[model samples]
Target chain A: MSLKKTRFKYLGESLIEGNIKITAILAIIAVFLIFFFILRESLPIFFNGEVQQEITFGKFFQGIQWQPVSDHPRFSLWPIIMGSLKVTMIALVFAVPVAIGAALYSSEFAGRRLKEFIKPVVELLAGIPSVVLGFFALIIMASFLKNIFGWTYRLNAVNAGIALGFAIIPAIYSLAEDALNAVPKSFREAALGLGATPWQTAVKVVLPAALPGVSAAVLFGMGRAVGETMVVLMAAGNAPLFSLNPLESTRTMTATIAAELGEVVFGSGHYHALFFIGLTLFTVTFVINLISWALFDGLMSKLYGAKK
Target chain B: MNSKGHLRKIKDRIKIGLTGSAVLLILAILAVILGTVIIGGYKSISWEFLTQPPKEGMTKGGIFPAIFGMVFSLLMMLIAVVPVGVATAVYLHEYARPDFILTKLIRGAVNNLAGVPSIVFGLFGLGFFIQFIGGSLDRSLGQSGLFGQPCILWASLTLALMNLPMIIVATEEALRAVPQAERAGALALGATKWQTIQNVVLPQAIPGILTGVVLVVSRGAGEVAPIMFTGAAYYLPYLPKLPTDQFMTLGYHIFVMTTQSPDIDATMPIAMGATLVLLALTFSLNIIAIIIRSRTRSQLRKGR
Candidate 1:
């Protein structure tokens, strides 16, 4: 009987060991496969270093002309980079104020019932797929902008940026709310006991205390906007023009990658360049996320004074 | 006294006016989009439209193929995602210690995966999955027609992989939320950790797991770019049949109809209708999840 029990235990151990192996294998598969494919496509560019003679690296870096596939392809990344930065900046400008205001209203000012109603609606906005938002922007918002501002290009960066702002508003709101709610009730009570008004207590005390968390939330929002593709792809007309005017058509690295990657010849230099673009994108967002994660962890530890 | 009172009243009025306008602006934006989608799509939706195939122009047609594609691809995607995702979550939550370097590395990788743009995934899928994996599989399988093409299976696989990290994160959160006291109690009653997890913890985490599954499905269904490169044809005549079969999906259908098809007017209404259906399906899943979550919360309150 003891022998049989020991065998049964051995059998159970083996099964768990097998399961663990499988899980490890799956993780390895995902990580390696992603690295291999991205690197594989990106290899052609490195190998064909001599074929890169069409333009000097300096011209590629500093030139204002941004056509890549044309006969005399000027690879100045400044305009699109500037375009992406400008749009993201505009989005942040619109989003930060509204999100902070909403977060304050939800956490501090709103009644319980109103808070419950408002929170879910805001989250639902976050869940609305970017594709749908892009579609709405292209069809309705772009037309509205054209009619109102009489813009030359109906589909431009401003409309896309506005749509993106709406997409990101909820992320900022939710994260900021998380930060705001983490402020101890005792702190609020202490402020109130000092005969401070609710607004004064909220603005002066809680907001300062929650600054780190608020910063984390803003960083996360920036990451979302930076990595966002569909809205930018569909709405930002894919013209590789070196223009700062939000009214004119421009192409972002992400939008270009999406629009052309599928059709690019496999093992070609252009394909690797697309991968290089992907690498740039991945690096930018990854850095943003790491910073945000560190900030959030630090703030949490400082607030709670270590894990239980 | 008169000046102070007048200034106070004016300040209050201005504050109220600004706040009210901001609130009204948000509501109006949401209302306009929702109202437009519903109103535009509602006129085109009908039993015939749902059942029939696309007609001469996309406007006067149906979205039957697209609907079929969506359903088939989603089913395959769920099949691909659930096992891998659940396993990954189990490993992360149950097996891997929090302070382990490998665990931390994996956590960062998963978070990075989520942050990577969807377009990058599309590019990756196109280069590797379609050109390499699908092409190889097609050659090895040596099937004809739609099977010859890298079709539904490939698309589904790519999407499933895309959603895997989210599911793992959601499931891990749910598992983490299961009270440690309950787990300890079960262990004290002579239950093994695995047994306790299986019998006690999993039962409690079922609703959360369902929520995660629902989220994966909703996100996977809406995906367009990955499928575009992976296997989605511009116009697949018939619905995909076997594992190798090529197909159309609602997300692709809407894109093609709106952008690619020459017959714009005919396609627009049908595209809107298809969009509405996809929206309805996703919205319903969310509503159901919300209901389930509230029910679970109430149950927890009662238990406490």
Candidate 2:
């Protein structure tokens, strides 16, 4: 009856427990295997003389050009890195306000019926596949945007980034809404008891109190934008440009790997190079995820006092 | 009550208006996207489009091959992920102490797994599954081509890995909803821990587990990156006859059609149709999962 942790006293307990324990640990094993294998595959680019003779670590960060196939192939990552940064910046700029505003409305202003309606709508948005969003951006949004903006290129960072915004809004909105909701009732009551309006209570009191979680939402949104592949692949004109222009065609790290990996020669420099890009992406997203998780955990502990 | 009060009230109303508009703007975006897709998708969708394979450089015919491959890979992925995901959830809920180090690590890994990019999973599939494990199998079995290549099995495994976290989280929430009284009653009847879990806990969790299964299938069906290099192909003359055979999938079909198709004008409709099919698939499955989850939640509430 006291179930802190079940102590099953039976003859075959060890067998059942042991079997379940192995499966239980598979998540950790999967994570380790992913990191290890990605790192393993990417190592050739650094130490393997064959790959190094073609591209060096110094040149990888320094070179402006990113042509992987040419008479003189260069493996510099600056342009694509710039592209990744540009697309991510545009996505964050577009998604953060819309997501935060939506979160605030759902958590603060909406009544029960409206909350229910908003919830499903967001879920439906979340449910849409990335490939479908990419298609929308490519076939529909791209042209629509062209008519408005009149860009030289049909597909550019803005088209992909805004589409990417839709892809990530669900995540940021949910987390931010949860954070805003988690602000204790006492905070709202106290603010209201001081003659503050509902808007003031929400914006000034609840939002500031939930800052950690809200920032975590922003960070998670950033991570999603950074690692998002298919949307950027299909929508972002896959030209690696060094310019900071949002209207230019951009190629991201994730998109580069996806678009190029199909044609790469196994065990070749290009192959390892793709793996290297994968490695960088993995590390960056992993770090971002961990930071956001920590921030979210901090918010949980702060608000709920370790119970949640 | 005073002059400054009027200014504050106006500012409050302004803030409320802005936030409310934000909500509408998001919903409007959602409507536009869905509206456009539905309008365009309806035109491309016909009976043959659902039942037949593409013909004449993919400008005509249906997407039956893509649907078949999507279902095939999803089934494989479910077979691989469910047991492990369910078992992990059980372990987290029933077996381990909440503060145990191993439990903390498992939970951390589960959360982190959710955040790993879809494309990273693709890389791991190539690096670990195809090259490493498959290469090892090929070497050990003295066969070169059989195991060391992109195929449905590897793709499913990659997808299984990608989806393990989601299933585990859902199952854990479901397991959590099974009230303590049920366990207490089972234990009071002299049932052992394993017996209580098997007889009492699992029965109530089935709906929740089914919800997780539906969700996994929906996600696995739409996931294109991990499968792109592992098994999903641009085109296949025939359906995949073996686990090792590459196959067409709806998501990858749309990707290739939009990005790399030779006849963009001709194939745009097919691509739109494929997008609609995938959208219909994931959306319906999501709605089903949502329904199941809500029902389970209500059941849990009532039982409590």
Candidate 3:
């Protein structure tokens, strides 16, 4: 009976193996569709050169303006790129230090009960809807920042950047804490045995070992900041004119896509322009996410290897 | 020499002090945000708000229509998402070989899908569900889909599609975490592979699956972007009595009140009230997840 059952198992396994190829094909098609759809809309803009007028890739890149819908259209991406960079950089400045500090405290310093309390609270930040966060930024955070800084624009990049920082802080902290906790107890013990203090061991030894993991966490948070639409849409004072000053009105590529795409004429040049913006956004984020996952995979090996 | 020792002492003190203060800062931020929302939300929520119909341009009006819409739509979303999600997860975990190129591809695709921006999902939903499927349903169910477009059913289906990648990933991780020993033991006892999976693995993994379901449900409930583009009505006067009916949802109501409505002040209160309700709804799902986890842990302890 057991021998016959083993034969049946092999038969089932072979049957399952036959279906796996189709599942893989289906999964690949889903991914391809995303690229195909984004590219389909975006490709026409480049092919026609209607917006750029030069038809040359160099000129498209070198252009200094970006009025996609205008008859004599300008397609300079500098300002929105600058706007996205400025907000993302400002957000990273606030998010990284706070998130790292919070992770260290949670993993190494806190009491068990306090850690439990803190963990869920941080997770709750992740659960908060981006729309609600954006609304809060628009109605409350923007006004508060305006009063505090006495900014020219009530809604500016700084307010949005700060709000995005807050939104991303929890995700960074959680991922970083997971990294820190994966460091071997024996490593810590050996450091202490060598007369190093807890602080010395954590900063000098544990932190270095956890760099790849921490970097992955930071990168993921940065991607979240960049891709986020609502917070920036509400708070970033959606003027297309790009400026370096955080206090001045500026709009990100995402904010531009969201605010204007709905109104754009479908299958028109303007629509293609929106898709090009999305493609740029998607490529940037896709690269960031790839780096993040690669780092995570790489770091997990180090953490697990050290344990063995 | 004495100065060096003093500086070292100061530095040590600073390290400890900074760590302690940072933890306190985190706790403080959590308390402040949660406290402010609950306090403000309390003042806004009333019996009327819970029981009666929402009145246009009135802050004190109820959210019955939105609440009903939320419940019915969520139920539809879960029904649509769970079956396909679980099937995919089961295939990925239990059936697929690690070396298969297809499995590797699926894994990569799932990762990418999770990171795709929510608004992109909104765009896809608008193009696919609302335009394609919605147009079909509109023609078939004539009067139901008649005058306007983007009914409740389309909205729910759109949200379900949005939740798919997330649910599959969560469920796969949960299934992967189930112990190998139990499965081997069941098979050694001469149980068929399907029977072993059904009788031994699934029951053990219920809590983990529940955790995945909770995450998907909470995320689905909070999603506003896709629903906005796909189907949600700005001012649904009556509750959505059927899937084909037009409706209002709490998320959309908040957006309308804040952005579109004439009575901005009146909407602020409603937005706050609606936010509280949305938060509470998600929190309860989380609580159910926690209960499942604890129950499983206790069962394990008893068995041991």
Give the top-scoring candidate (DockQ).
Answer: 2
* Runs in model 1 lying further than 4 Å from the true structure: A21-25, A49-62, A306-308, B1-27, B135-150
Model 3, B19: alpha-carbon shift in Å?
A: 3.4
Model 1, B1-304: lDDT tens per residue? 9898677667655644454344455556667777777887998899988988886756576888888888898999999888778777877887788898877777777777777677667767766777777667667878434333457777888788778787888778778778889999998997766787788887788887888888778887777877877777777667777867778887777766765678766677787787787777776776676677667767777877
- lDDT (Cα atoms) of all candidates against the true structure: 0.75, 0.89, 0.75
Best by TM-score: 2
Q: TM-score of each candidate? A: 0.91, 0.97, 0.88
All models, DockQ values?
A: 0.42, 0.81, 0.37
Candidates ranked by DockQ = 2, 1, 3
lDDT of 1 by residue, A1-308 (tens): 49999778668966975696477457556756776787776655555664455433344377676666767666676776776786787779988877877787777777878776776677556656667777778767888889998898988888888888887888888888888888888778999999665666777898888889999999999988887877877777767777778777767777777777667665554556677777677778878988888887777777675223
Superposed by TM-score, candidate 1 places the C-alpha of residue A7 at a distance from the truth, in angstroms, of 3.8
Candidate 2 residue pairs that clash: none
Q: Clashing residue pairs, candidate 1?
A: B58-B266, B58-B267, B59-B266, B59-B267
